[model samples]
Target: MIRFALILTSLLGLGITCQAADKQDLSLLTRTAEQFARRQLADSDAKITARKLDPNLSLPACDSLEAYLPPNGRLSGRSTVGVRCARDGWSINVTLDIQLFSQAVVASRAIRAGEVIQATDVQLQRVEIGQLPSPPLGSIDQALGKTPVVGIGQGIPLRADMLRAPAVIQPGQSVRILVNGDGFQVSGEGKALGQAALGQSVSIRTNNGQVVTGVVTGVGQVTVTP
Candidate 1:
C-alpha cells in the first residue's frame, strides 16, 4: 500500500509540471506577438502638410497624414489610434478614420500596404481648412460701360448703344454684350451667317451700304453697331 501511494503522488507531480510548462510557453508566445506588432507599427520619421479638404467652402477638415514606420507591420489586425496634422510648425486639431491591412508576411514579420504606414490598425488623420483669397476689387472711378460685368458684386443695366458683335464667334456660343437698343439685326459673311447661332455675333452689310457689327439676339433680329 505504501508503494502504491508513492507512485500515485509521483504521477500527479509530473502532470502538474507539464501543465506549468505549457502555460509558460503560451505566455512567451503572447509576449513575442505583442512585441512584433509594436515593432511593425513604430513610426520614426514622418512628414505632414495642409491641403484643401473640399472645394467651394473653407473649413478645417483638409489635412494629410505622412508617417514612416517599419517595413514589416500588419495594419489589418490593429485598430486606429489617432490622427494628427502638422501646421504652423505644430500639429493641429484634425481627425480622420482610416483602416489598413497586411500585405505580406515572412519569417514571422508582416508587411502592410506599401511603406511608411505605422500600423495595420485604424488611424485618424488630422487636417485643417483655410480661407481662400478674395478677388481683386474694381475701381470705383472707372466709367460704367454698357456691357454689364456680371460678377460677385452688384452691376448696372443693359444699354442699347453699347452692344457690338464679337469677332471670331462660332455657332452654339453664347455671348453677353451691350446693344444700342432692343431692336437689332444679325448678319454675317457667307460662312459666318449660316453658322452663327442665337446670342452670337457676326458682321453685316447695313442697308446704308456700311459694314456694321451686331449680336444675334433672335433668329433674324440682330443688334447692329449704331
Candidate 2:
C-alpha cells in the first residue's frame, strides 16, 4: 500500500510539471504572434493592443510556433494574428486593436467648392489616423493650389479626393504652343479650346487655322509631341 501511494504521488507531480511547461510554451507563442504583428503593420507610430488569452483555454504543447497573417488581413483597425504549432496540430489566433497617430491637414476655416486651397487656409495637426473616414492630406505642399470639389467646414480633415489641381488655362485663352522633334524646337501662338490645369492635355487652334492637341506644360504653355 505504501509503495502504491508513493507511485500515485509521483504521477501527480509529473502532471503538474507538464502543465507548467505547457503554459510556458503557450506564452512564448503568444509573444511571437505579437512580434509578427508589429512588423507587418504599416504605422511606425502605431500603438498595439491585444487581450490576454483565456486562462481556462486548453491547448496541447507545441514544439514550435509559426506566426502569420490570414488571407485578406489588413494592418489597420481590428486585425487578427494566427499562431500555429504544426507538430502538435494545434493553432490559435490572437485578435489585436491598433491605433495610429500622424500629422494631417485640416481646414482652418470654411472652404467653398471650386476655391483654391491656400497655405493659410489649412494647418497641420496630429490626429488618430485609424479613425479617419478617409486618408487625410499629410502635408501642406499637397494642399496648396488645389481646388476643393466640395465645401468643407472649419477644422475638418482634408482628404486628397476632395481636391484637384486648379485650372491654369481657360477656354479661348491665348497660349504658347511648343513643338519639339528630334533636333528642332519651335513655338507658336494658339487659342485654348478648353480649360486645362498644368500638365493636362489641351486642344489648341493655331493662328494658321490648324487645330492641334498638346499637353499643358505651364500657365500659358502647351507642348506638342509628334
Candidate 3:
C-alpha cells in the first residue's frame, strides 16, 4: 500500500509540472513585446531587443496576450513593455532596449551664437537620436537663415530651441504700418520700439508719438487695426 501511494504522488507531481510549462510560452511573450515596441516607433528607424520572460515565472494560461507601453514612458533607449492577458486580466512588465536612428540635420561645422546659418553650415546625417526632448531638424532648408541662440558643436543635431528666429523688425528701425477696418485699409509709418520675429507682436510708435501694438508681417513691416 505504501509503495503504491509513493508512485501515485510522483506521477501527479510530474503531470502538474508539465501542465504548468504548457500554460505559457515564454518565446511568444518576448516576440509580442518586440512587435509592440516596433509599432510605437514605426516612423523612425529603430532596433529593439526584448528580454525573454523568465522560465520560472508562472502565469495563468492566457487565451489572449496583449502588449502596451507605460504612461509617459520613454520610447528610446532602455524601456519597459507591459504585457497583459486579455482574457485573464493578469499583467507583467518586460525589459526592452531600443536604439533609435533617423536622418536629422546636424551642424557640418562648429557654429557660433548669433551667426546666420548658411546652406553649407548644416547637413543631414543618419545618427542615433536617443530620447531627444525635441525632434531634430531634418533638412538644410529648415536650418537656413536661423541663427543659433548658443554655440553648437560640430556634428551635433539641431533642434528648434537651439536656434533663434531672425528678427524681421529691429528696435528703432523704420517700419511700414498698416491699419485695417471692417472693409477699408489704412497705411502709415512708425519706428519699431522693439525687435520681433515674423508673426510676433511688436510695439510701433507712430509718427504722431502714440504707441500701438502690431504683428510683424514682413521685413520692416507691422500690421495693426484701429
Best by TM-score: 3
- What candidate 3 gets wrong by more than 4 Å, as runs, is 1-17
Q: lDDT score of model 3?
A: 0.90
Worst ten-residue run, lDDT, model 1?
Answer: 127-136
Tell me each candidate's TM-score: 0.21, 0.81, 0.84
Q: Number of the top candidate by lDDT?
A: 3
Whole-model lDDT values for every prediction? 0.34, 0.86, 0.90
Please provide, for model 1 over 145-191, each residue's C-alpha lDDT reduced to its tens digit, 9 standing for 90 to 100.
11122211122211222222222445434333334645664433322
lDDT of 2 at 53: 76
Clashing pairs in 3: none
Which candidate, 1 or 3, has the higher TM-score? 3
lDDT of 3 by residue, 56-156 (tens): 88776776999998898776888999899998898888889898999999999999999999989989999888878888998778889989999999999
TM-score of 1: 0.21
lDDT of 2 by residue, 110-196 (tens): 999989888999999887788777889999999999989999999888998898898889999999999999999999999999998
Query: Relative to the unseen true structure, what is the C-alpha lDDT of residue 137 in candidate 3, on a scale of 0 to 100?
Result: 90
